[model samples]
Target: MTDRNRRFLLKARPNGMPKTSDFALVEEALPDLQPGQFLIRNHYASLDPAIRGWLDDAPSYMPPVALGDPVRASTVGVVAESKAEGFKAGDWVMGLNAIEEYSMAQAGGFSQLIDIGNVSSPTHFLSVMGAVGLTAYFGVTEILKPEAGQTMLVSGAAGAVGSLVGQLGKQAGCRVIGIAGGPAKCARLTDDYGFDAAIDYRGKSAEALSDEIGAAAPKGIDLVFENVGGIGLDATLLHLNRFARVALCGLISEYNSEHYGARNLWQLIVHSATVRGFLISEFLDRFAEGAAAMAKLVGEGRLRFDEHIEEGIDNALPAFLRLFEGSNQGKMILKLI
Candidate 1:
């Protein structure tokens, strides 16, 4: 093992959008391993939109990232050393390993072993078998419960969570419409992910988008996988059919802003709609079911996934910002090794 560990440290609190300047890289000596402890070499770190929420000092579902902490990140790694029972050297695992070259993880903190026999790659532990896939599964099955032949719309459609949600909607026999930023993303949603229709948000304004979505779902929308708040939510609200259900996932559009102005929620009352916010953490026990279903679909060619990987850990900040800029085409990940 190396004498010094290299890791990304949270240097300062972000006021708006976080930049590379907000983080600092530091080298420190590794501490002696205690009982029931293990050391790991990180391979890939998952960059998620929810990380922005973790940077703020607010009361949320999870605690904020403390100053000088190794900027919390979910990573897949191989164990290098262990003093813990049931774990040994060369064991591949997934856990909250922080953004570091090496980390000492407590035995009980994390130990989700990767089943490479079924999955295509290790990073699937962070995408299809991780929180992203579970978020999509629960958001579609429990919240939306879309009926066959009904129409469903998804915002942030090409993203990790939204892309899976669109596929699950299709599997349920719903006509799925995806809203992404560019033609490339839109095309991938339709051609690769099996979405029924794709709307390029960058090509037209929100007002102009209303007609396109309306034409696609002429009977009005039965379900909305809301990954973006603000204007996207407003547009979906305008087309919600009576008894329409909306699963409110992450709101990427409003994450960096100081104030996210309210939209016309009265449309919900007029249309008799229901919107519910969800977090995957609340349904952790059901992860096995979600993973099994996703794996089965993938094995049958009924569902597909893509990863937009940026090489090296140094590219994390730039790659993460791509979510807001509409630059990433699929699940964005940073290869740390």
Candidate 2:
């Protein structure tokens, strides 16, 4: 192991999309491990849209990453040394680590050893077997509760969570329609991820997209798994069946913007539909159950996922920015090790 640890510290809060200047890379000596503490050599770090919310000094799910501190992220790594019970050197683990080369974690903190024995890659622990899958699983299975023969619509269907949401909806016997950004992603949604139909939203106006959604789900949408909020949610809201349900997930389209309004929200009243927003942390007690179910589906070849890995810690900032730009195909991961 190297004597130095490399990390990215927040230098300033971003005004819009984060720039590389907002962070500073620094190398410091690895601190001595204390009792009840373990040192992790981070291999991969997850790049998520939620990280943008954390950059601002605002009230939300968790506290903002304090200025001058390493940016917080979910990471998979190996224990390089340990002084904690239930952990040992060489054990693989995942936790709310940081965008750093090494991290010090406590025994009963967010850090937990992960069993990657049945998976082909360690990155799966950060994708299908991690919080990404857990969010999709609980959001779809528990929140939406889509029934067989119902028509379900998923926005951002080509993304990591949306991709899984679409597949889980299919497994529940729903006729799934996916709305993605471009033709390639739209094609992958139907051909690769098992969506019944896919709508490309690239060059369409709001009315045009709404018409496309209507064409795709002529029977009207029974369930809407909304990930991209702005135009997509507005479009999906126009065709909700009576007593329809909406699992409001991430609103990526409006994440970096100041104005966010949905024009068709009145449809909820007209259709007597329910729309609920959730955070994965709220289902912490049942995470194991969700993870197990997702793993089973993946192991059985019933669920699918993809990862867009950016090599090395130096590329972390660029990889993160790609999420907002819609350049990432699936889960965006920084391969540090």
Candidate 3:
């Protein structure tokens, strides 16, 4: 373990897409571990869009990252120092840590030990079997429960959670339609991920996208696993069938937008459809159950997910910006080691 730590701190709250000026890189001495505290040498930091929301000094599920504090993120690492029982040096763990070379965590907190024997890769804990997996699982099975023969729409269908959600919808016997940005991703949605149909939402207005959605779901949308909101969601809302269920997961499109223009909310009232905002944290107690189910599927080769890993801590800001730029190939991860 190094005597010092490198951190990507929030220097300023961004007005739109974050830039280098919004952050500051600093090196600081690692402090002595106190009783009940354990130090982890982070191997990889998960770069999720949710972290973007945390940068704003607005109301959210978690507090915004304080200026000069290391940006909050989920990281997988090996314990390097432990003053706590049930944790030891070399033990692999994952937790809501920070974008840094090392993070200090406490026992009985959000951090949990990982069974490397069962995991295909430690990074999988940050992808298919971790928060992303749980988000797709509970967001589908628990929240937007789909019935056989129903039509399900997944926005950001090529994303980490969206990809898994599409496959699960298929397994549940719903005809799944995916909305991605490009022809390449749209093609993979059907060819690789088994989505019944794929809609490319790029370079299209809300009306144009809605027309495509109508053609894709001629029977009307019975369920929506929405990730990218704004026009994408507004378009989807226009096709909601009576009593439709929408698992409102994210609004990535509006994250960097100064003007939030979602104009089709009246569709909800028109169709009596339900939209429930989903946060995986709500199902924290059942995370193990969700992880086991997803792991089994991955083990049997029934699940397919992707990871777009960018190497080095120095590239953290650029790597994170790829998420909003729609350039990441899969789950965004920063490999520090």
Please name the candidate that would achieve the greatest lDDT relative to the true structure: 3
* lDDT tens readout by residue for model 1, 1-337: 6767888888888878888789988888988888999888888888888888888898888799999998788898888889987678888888876888888887767566676667778888888778788888888898898789999999999988999999999989999999988788888899889999999877576688888888888899999999987777787788999988889897888889964654768988998999899888778778889888877877887778888888876777888888788788677888988
lDDT of 1 at 286: 82
Show model 1 residue runs off by greater than 4 Å.
none
What candidate 2 gets wrong by more than 4 Å, as runs, is none
Preferred candidate (lDDT higher): 1 or 2: 2
Worst 10 contiguous positions by lDDT, candidate 2:
251-260
lDDT at residue 212 of model 3 (Cα atoms)? 98
| lDDT at position 10, candidate 2 | 97
Higher lDDT: candidate 2 or 3?
A: 3
TM-score (all chains, Cα) for each model: 0.96, 0.98, 0.98
Model 3, poorest ten-residue lDDT window?
A: 257-266
lDDT of 2 at 110: 93
Candidate 2, residue 220: how far the Cα is off, in Å? 0.8
Candidate structures ordered by lDDT, highest first? 3, 2, 1
Which candidate gets the maximum TM-score versus the true structure? 3
Cα deviation of 293, candidate 3, in Å: 0.4
